[model samples]
Target: MKVRVGFGYDVHALVPERDLWLGGVKIEHTMGLQGHSDADVLIHAICDALLGAANMRDIGYHFPDTAGEYKDIDSKILLFDTMELLRDAGYTLGNIDATVAAERPKLNPHIPEMKRVMADVLQVDVEDISIKATTTEKLGFTGRQEGIAAYATVLIQK
Candidate 1:
């Protein structure tokens, strides 16, 4: 089997009134991420990682923000489509490990649900998807709660 590894990172500004979507589930928060889509930072990162591992280019290339069809679209749909692209290219996901950086709203409590949702979208075992969160030690944009960011690394095989 041929195995490949890839890494991805993404960030979105937080703003009031918008719904906070992470991984593939909604989290109650005073602020939500700003983006053309639902702005699921974790999912975007995972998508990029998977695509990169397959040497298929990045997420924005495949799913452009300029497209009207994607406006405020569900990120889970994008994740599902990304998997289809990978499968069509003769690649299968092995596992994913990801981390979200945030300052407030306590991400730990939501991790299990995030993992479940992401696993379902990727059609992988829940154990194959690992979601971790950190506070950034109150040291950066994430620490100040200006935005949220996520990093993901994935392994894929053919």
Candidate 2:
């Protein structure tokens, strides 16, 4: 079997009147992430990592913000499509480990659901997906609640 690993990072500014989406789960928050889509930072990072591992390019290459089709679209669809791309390349998921950074809304409580949702989307076992959360210790944009950031590392095999 051939195995490859990839890493990804993403961030988005916080804005009012939007919904906060992370790892395919919606979390209640005073401010949501700003983006052309639902702005799920965690999902975007995972998508990038998976695509990179397969050497298929990043998420923007497949889903462009300039395109109207992605506007206000559900990020879960993006994640699902990403998995299809990986499968088409003759690769299957091995595992994914990801982290999210934010100052508020307490992510730990929601991790289990996030993992469940991602696993369902990727058609992988729940054990294959791990989601972690952290704060920037009041040191950066995430710490100040100005935005949210996420990092993901993934292993894929063929």
Candidate 3:
């Protein structure tokens, strides 16, 4: 068996009049992350991590923001597509650990749902995916509530 590891990071600015999406679950918040897609930073990071582990290109290489088809697209679709890419390459997921950083709306309460939702999309057991949420201690953009960020690490094997 061949095993590989990959890591991914993503950030999006918070903006009004948008829904906050993370790990395929929507959270009620005053502001949402802005992006060409639904701006689910957690899913994007996980997609990148999976692609990197498979030695495939990043998410943007597969799903370009320049494409109108992706405008306001659901990040869960992107995760499903990413999984398909890995499946095509004969790579199966071993595990995933992801973290989200934010200063408001308190993400911990929503983590379980996020894990279940993302695991369903990835076609893995909920145990195979771990999601964590934290505050940046009022230091940076996330700390200042200007944006949200996510990081993900994945293991894949063939």
The sequence of per-residue lDDT tens digits that candidate 1 reaches over residues 74-157 is 999999999999999999999999999999879899999999888888888999999999888998899999999999999999
The true-versus-predicted C-alpha distance at residue 55 of model 2, in Å, is: 0.7
**How would you encode candidate 3's per-residue C-alpha lDDT over 1-158 as one tens digit per residue?**
99999999999999999999988888999888899999999999999999999989899999999999999999999999999999999999999999999999798889899989988888899999989889999999999999999999999999
Worst 10 residues of 3 by lDDT: 114-123
lDDT of 2: 0.95
lDDT of each: 0.94, 0.95, 0.94
Model 1 clash pairs are none
Per-prediction TM-score, please? 0.98, 0.99, 0.99
lDDT for model 3, please. Answer: 0.94
Task: Identify the runs in model 2 with alpha carbons over 4 angstroms from their true place.
Answer: none
RMSD of each: 0.6, 0.5, 0.6
lDDT of 2 by residue, 98-124 (tens): 999998989999999999999999999
